[model samples]
Target: MIEKVKGILAGLAFRLIALLTLGQISPILSACVIIERDGKILLIDRSDGLGYTIPGGIVHYSETVEQCVLREAREETGYDVLLTGFVGVYSSLKRDPRFRAVALAYQGQIVGGTEHGSGEGSTCWQAPGDVFGHMAFDCESMLKDYLSEHQRFS
Candidate 1:
């Protein structure tokens, strides 16, 4: 089917990009946000076949990490989010299989915009517990850390 082919092509593309840039490139800096509402979390079913990821992407050179988080959230999830708190920075070498990457994660609340999907993936709200094992590229780790931080405070 077309969707299957698309997934294959996307996975191949992701692998190729990773192989082509690995080690040759410096640490990839990206930002993501955790948005929880109505006892559910916002998630993306990635088109790259890289499993589920939160609303985020690589930080543009033109923007700060916070700005990247906000921009990525709006672009990928169709929601303008307000970052309420900083979760933590995740810099594990194996965080992303494609390359060594660093991430700035934040806790966000939806402010405006209509919900929809983009080229990255489809956005959906699901229980945090239901999504634990399906996350991609260290996203589960990010979520766990965010939950731990929030629980400690709340």
Candidate 2:
């Protein structure tokens, strides 16, 4: 038994040493979601440089999920949003073209800001069906989950 424990500890130490030598791994993180209200969804065009995507952005190192969501919404849409509930979490290795990102999705309601465009794309309210049809990523699953939650609660 002592020999087996020693072997396990040695194996763990070797793995730790190898991992430390491999250098730091960059973490890709983001917070976003399909903002829905009444029967429409919010969509935006990227202001940075790319195809149209849902309104959201990367999660800064020192920011909480709530803070990141609020900041991202305000930066991209020029409006402050009140997130009501969590929709889901998406962690696809290839979700972003440049890096892997784990996204925290939320169900939000707009409390302020006139409907306007900002960021890389124009901001507009689209029909729920149309929004799904034109989504930039695999957000339909998230949207579906949101709808399911609504039905379950309602």
Candidate 3:
């Protein structure tokens, strides 16, 4: 399928770039969108079975972080979203097993499109409190940070 080929090519390209940089390249930049509706958050059950996490991925070379989050949300969750505001930035050496990454998290709202799962796995809305224990990656921490800030405003 085209998606599989794209994934392969992307992995190759990423590895090639990492090699070219002699590993001196800065951490890869990524963006994630926090989509909440009715007090439930949108989450993806990653295909690799790494558990649930927010919809996001690496930022493409031609796109801004905002554009990347929007695109990722649409691609992975089948939902078109509008970025409302930034939540925070997260970076840690051990955050991602593949490599160091710096992710910009933004709050968003669904504006169009329908919710569905892609090859990434199933998509669902879950209570914010229920998601932390089931999360993968640094999602638990990210959500905590976002929720704490959100509470202050609410």
Ranking by lDDT: 3, 1, 2
Q: Which ten residues in a row have the lowest lDDT in candidate 1?
A: 145-154
**Best model per TM-score:** 3
Off by more than 4 A, model 3 = 1-22, 150-154
Please, what are the lDDT tens digits per residue for candidate 3 over residues 6-69? 6557657766888998977777898898888888999997766678889998999999988899
Better of 1 and 3 by TM-score: 3
> Candidate 3 overall Cα lDDT vs. reference?
0.82
- For each candidate, what is the lDDT? 0.81, 0.67, 0.82
98-132, model 1: which lDDT tens digit per residue? Answer: 55678888899999999999887789998879988
- What is the alpha-carbon lDDT for the whole of candidate 1? 0.81
How close to the true structure is residue 3 of candidate 2, measured as C-alpha lDDT? 28
Clashing pairs in 1: none
TM-score of 2: 0.72
In candidate 3, how many clashes are counted? 0
Q: For every candidate structure, what is the RMSD over all alpha carbons to the true structure, in angstroms? A: 4.5, 12.7, 4.2
lDDT of 2 by residue, 1-154 (tens): 4423543565466456657868354445678756777787776754443435667877888998789888888877777899888877776655554444577788788889866675356787776666565555556666777777842211
